[model samples]
Target: MSENQYAISEYHDADEINARLKELVGQPLHPIRRDKMEEYLRYFDTKCSRSKAMTDEAKTIIPGGVQHNLAFNYPFPLAVRKVEGAYMWDEDDNKYIDFLQAGGPTVLGSNYPPVRDKVLELVRECGPVTGLFHEFELKLAQKVQEHMPGIEMFRMLGSGTESVMAAIRAARTFTGKKKVIKVGGAYHGWSDQMVYGLHIPGTRTFEAKGIPGSASRHTQEFYPNDLGQLHRRLIANRLRGGTAAVIVEPLGPESGTRPVPFDFNQQVRELCDRFGALLIFDEVVTGFRVGMGGAQGYFGVTPDLTIFGKCITGGYPMAGGVGGRKEVMQRFAPGIGGTGERAYIGGTLSANPMSCAAGYYAIEEMERTNAAILAGRAGDRLTRGLKEIIERLGLPFVAYNQGSIVHLETGAVMLLDVRNPVKLLKELKPRKHMMEEMGAAYMSQGVVTLAGSRIYTSMADTDEIIDEALNRFETVLSSVEGIA
Candidate 1:
């Protein structure tokens, strides 16, 4: 760990998160309490009428009445009116202590003022995109390299999905290998190549529908925190052809919904070196939110390529990127790529002055206030308070966090084996439904979370805001206490 107090959030300085997660993983958490779920569903339908109306209206035009699956909460999604700092108001004017943090990008909080102002200024100044270079893009890349010394070069992209695709292409092109291995249950993105073995590790493709089996033939899975498995896989792959890259969410999928050991990254780094595989850190969720340098910096293990998502600006139009050693990053260049042939990657709206300004100002604000540490502190407060609530209510639900990213796993149903068609169809239905219900339960009580399983705190979440969130959380706990 660094004696420098600033970058301390990078390291696993606090074991409480790991300890709590270990206990939760072992504990037998049941399906969401049936009565509790029914009760919450009723409450949601009754109290969230405005949201229901909006969703109904949306479904008329949009499939499922929601654009993103993340919006598909139980009963319906809560439509937001506005958000600022640590709170958000719904269309019904109900207030919530914002914990979703826009799925881990808005460490400064939604519509953060300074960044927003800068983005507006840039939009007015340059009209979003001119297919030309902008100074802010250089500044943003410089800022990333400044904090993460591992990144000798960087490229901004459209979204985390785009970034993942670029990184995968770069890795394969740079190494002249085809095989890609990622941790089981980790979600790199929705890109076709990365759609293999998502949500649960070691499973057959669930989200790979319509994507040909051959599409994922070279892609494989390794269990998280299991270096032995990775070593074995790399050696196995070497027999046929060298593994191009080993990509992973440094803290585990969904920002440590399944937390990893403190030394996991170091072990992976060593193993990647021994196996001649490029280590790619998928920092889309962990990037700047974990610390200034990200999980690679936190663990003191730099990967050959790093995938950045939502690091540029939270909830903005354009987000995500790839930062890595100059050699690997050069593969995306127009002229002689790292592979001696251009590894194709580009975007019309990518690295526009608007997104760059938002990212540049966002980082500036976060650094000025040490937003990562403060957000992590808020996460600690929220997690601890949730633990106390769970204990008091005697609920079997689990709670743990990594820096600002929090996980409240109600069951391990998502990890169920998908290879068995019968089991897959039978188990996933109720589990998915109830999970959304649990999210709705929290939403009903003025707390908007990420699918009711995760919480992303922001620097704006003070003790008071967290306490307010906790009070709402207690209501959720009480509603679900029937199971206990």
Candidate 2:
């Protein structure tokens, strides 16, 4: 499982990377034909009847008829029965290409045989959790720190939000400062403090409902790719209290939905050094997927602390964590007797045998098969074909990919100013509906994408799979063109 044995390809070249980025042309979002969309909605009702019945039953228990926000799709949520490499069969036994990949984990593919078998065997033997330490925990840590050298010390959490909460605490404790800066739109997690400015950069308190103002008073937001604004914010924080950390999703918000300059992260690292602030890269999505070492390694900009999510356990449940160098990370060390500043974070399920075993083998599998590189190639082919499709249709819909993390921006509704009721009320619903319809359109034609607007390609998506997906994608476009 040595990383050196399998050579990972470079993610992107600067010139070509910008071209792909620029080619994400659609912004205000061309609305899909209304007549065609209504037809698709009618078709969904009949086609997904079983899903509707199951969702109705689940709604009686679960608040939204689904446990997670991701499950909420057009028409109704799909209750899946089976998952394999690049494909899923829902409750009604409808087959579709699974581009969602469980929200970007399972880079090797959904329910990968090797990792799943090992996990199942371990569960049968030692059990899921024994409420005590296990060997797999140490092995998982060793595997992670082996590839990501920045992680001299590591700790696990039940979810990515917990890791973010832990990272914020550690940064403040280590630096003895209160203020934290984050790039707007770059989601770290749903933790209260980190929700100050979300969905759009510089949108302070717009979506911070149910969260008190005091919760985020110390947490400020700055525009991505704008080092000058960050400099100003850092300077402002220094007057009352120094900035403890600057948190960011290295790929920009929504995984490059708002793309950053290639050198943006490096410059942020330099600024953090100058300002005595800790640099925290929330690689919850990008970690292990961008490369064996994550986005930091790909861009050659190391952060003081890193957060991980889906890639941690390769789509297994209870997968998330934080890691950092010895000096800063040791703040989480137990047995300190509450004398020193420690970020109290741990979940009953965190680092259990099941998650640890799954992660150990999952990372091993990724390295063994050159999964990152292969997935990146699949993403390249997928995005390329999408661009050609858009051109052929003469549509302005935007499509781009950063390695395996892909985005198809049918509507950048997040960019709309919710402040203006007139414009917001007029524009939001249709654009949002466009996104949902696009997603439903893709699902009907045998593909399942993330949020109906984004995609996360996997190593399972080979050329043949990509070609199959492209055919389905063209059908989705045809729905917009009223081509039946």
Candidate 3:
């Protein structure tokens, strides 16, 4: 497919976006007015009494009353009883526009009937797993390879974290090197080495609690979009044991929360080639969301290896994999098939029959409906509408999208980095709180978002749905303290 055929029709200028983000963080917090905030919070206490009570009871057993960090809403997490198309109903039967989209995996929309029916049929026929090979495994692999030609060989895993671990291990084994470098603030996974620089650049090990120092000694990070800094690290690692791989989220870290220039990936590929290090694309979010061919296709930059995540199974469980050129992927061969060296990765439920079938059917469905492009249209509409709202309200918030992955920076919380330690220390708490409040305000207005900052639009979001969402968003944005 051509570049325009993919989801992202236009790539935002990364430098300009970053400059606007800097200006946003430099300003005072423009949170919802106190009266408006209290009124919104009342929605949780009164209207959502059932959800609040249920979460409170679960808090006695579950840590933070939620298993996933994304569920950590400001007032409290809501118990979702139903999801379909572009909406969700909480336990209290309150409806919300589902902008979260199950954290960007449901591009085809939540609980899509076609995919779900196929899964149910497969379950009734042969159960979920069989500890052996199935035809859908080959079908899923072939489907992925058909879309992402760079992924000549593929290995299915349990989750995105496992896929990252496997990719790093394969890179090291193939190159006979020990070090790996990643863009600071990019979230590849929670593995020890990958956790070195979490959230903010230069804050290495800040969130590496309980992980020993030795766990990440060989891992390093450089500032986002700084090719010079990356080149320096590549040269430095040369004097040591040499770099194994340089991994990145093709759009930017945290799903383009920090957007990179259009040519950033191509430059990184060149540096990797010059330094004899493998380039890995952590496409956990961008793989299918950007297009059937992924960000590599969008940017026309091929990586030695690419990681896959939830969208592989269309939001089903056990959705992760690693794919790339045949030579490097050979390192993941199991049993006695390998020549001599092996990466040695295993999972009891990896490539289960249900997951494979779900992935195969999902990809087929995505291709048939051109879901990525449709979802991207929804994202474009939503983003344009959000920008209009922010502009009309005279707010400092920023909004942008890379296809279906949309970011609305109300507090610019994720933009903070250790590059400005004093500023980080002074504002991190209030900024984070403001982000949470923004989420609460949106929820009260019957819109669900990912932490009040990120949103995932799906093929199900029609122009009508997007316009309605924009109206709700305006309700919250207009409530900002300084808004006219």
Candidate 4:
């Protein structure tokens, strides 16, 4: 064994020291009980009667009273009427400073004049799809390549899920390996193969019902930040013909379902190299939002294949595909047993001109103005303000960010700490109802945010808007008192 392996084994063998280290690392920083979070939720429930009414009405027509399952909150998602710049007008004619940013795609903000004008112009000219190549496709792909030089060739899809599904298929075909290893809690779209251990945790299982057990049979799962465990799994699977690829979010910097250390990704890259497995970075969330070059550039560990979406389309319905070494991606070309043998990837609306036009313009705008840096600055200001409030209130909460992606979690630090751990675990357990309440409260106060998951900033969000949101956050948090 190598020196590093010998040292790791020796460290694990030291039972007494390991126990002490675990205890030290598991101490609570702040102690806020789960019951308080629940109480706060109950209070918001009473205050958000309008939201409930809307949800009830929506249930009659829409599934779960929302278009996407992730969009559904405890009270009900507010129906949006119109959005311009960084603000949204909901169905009740209430105005809100929108930080949701269409779940991170609207980095340039909704209805930005330039992108809007271009999309409308395209619509007027030739409708959405033509079943033929469009000029906009090449333009957008070229822009993506220009920004992130790692992506030599690219494809477009309708959603992040579709892109991820296609990337997985391409990886399997390219490597001739059937199994894939994914991080336990990182979300990578809704396909059956990538669905295992999604929102609903524990082992390899799907969050949605009716998923075939056999769908993820060859798919293995590993915890983030545990290199030894990952290596063991890779070796075990390799003995049986190896894995096609190891797919990860590359930034679980925040520990939740899978909080990873900074070195975790670097180590994972080394292991993948040793195992002869392709590494796939699912950058749908981190794509253009985190930086113009995505997480790969931020971390400086290039992957064999990378998947992108969200911010690339600038909030349009367009999603994107995998890009990597020429050889691996060439598996998609014809005559390698034709299209039937290699990855048969296609979509009716893939790379439609309208989306491509919007995407190309959006990327151009972001680069021209360096909007990503501005967005990061805004996120920093907001997170710092929230953290200050939490400290003053003596609340057990933590706030952190990855460039523009920000998250605020109550009891997150305590959950990570605490010797017994059960108390914090129970407190942090899925409080969907509480999250919905928080969302409604924020909405009523004219500040919109995702329920404890992710939030974004836009070029249109001014200092005044951010300040307003922070002040409202203080009020909402104070109102909750001992709650989350």
Please tell me which model should have the higher lDDT, number 2 or number 4.
2
lDDT of 1 by residue, 214-294 (tens): 988888888766778888899999987889999988887657766777788888888888888899999888788888888
Assess each prediction's global lDDT (C-alpha) against the native. 0.79, 0.83, 0.93, 0.70
TM-score (C-alpha, index-matched) for candidate 4:
0.85
What's every prediction's RMSD, in angstroms?
2.9, 2.9, 1.1, 7.0
Which candidate achieves the best lDDT against the true structure?
3
Model 1 has an lDDT value of: 0.79
Pairs with backbone N, CA or C atoms under 3 Å apart (clashes), candidate 4: 28-418, 36-483, 255-259
**What is the Cα-based lDDT of residue 49 in candidate 2?**
86
Candidate 1 ranges beyond 4 A from true positions: 3-39, 335-340, 415-426, 481-484
TM-score of 2: 0.93
Model 3: weakest 10-residue lDDT segment is: 332-341
Query: Alpha-carbon error at 108 in model 4, in Å?
Result: 1.1
> Candidate 2 — worst ten consecutive residues by lDDT sum?
1-10
> Which candidate, 3 or 4, would have the higher lDDT against the true structure?
3
lDDT for model 4, please: 0.70
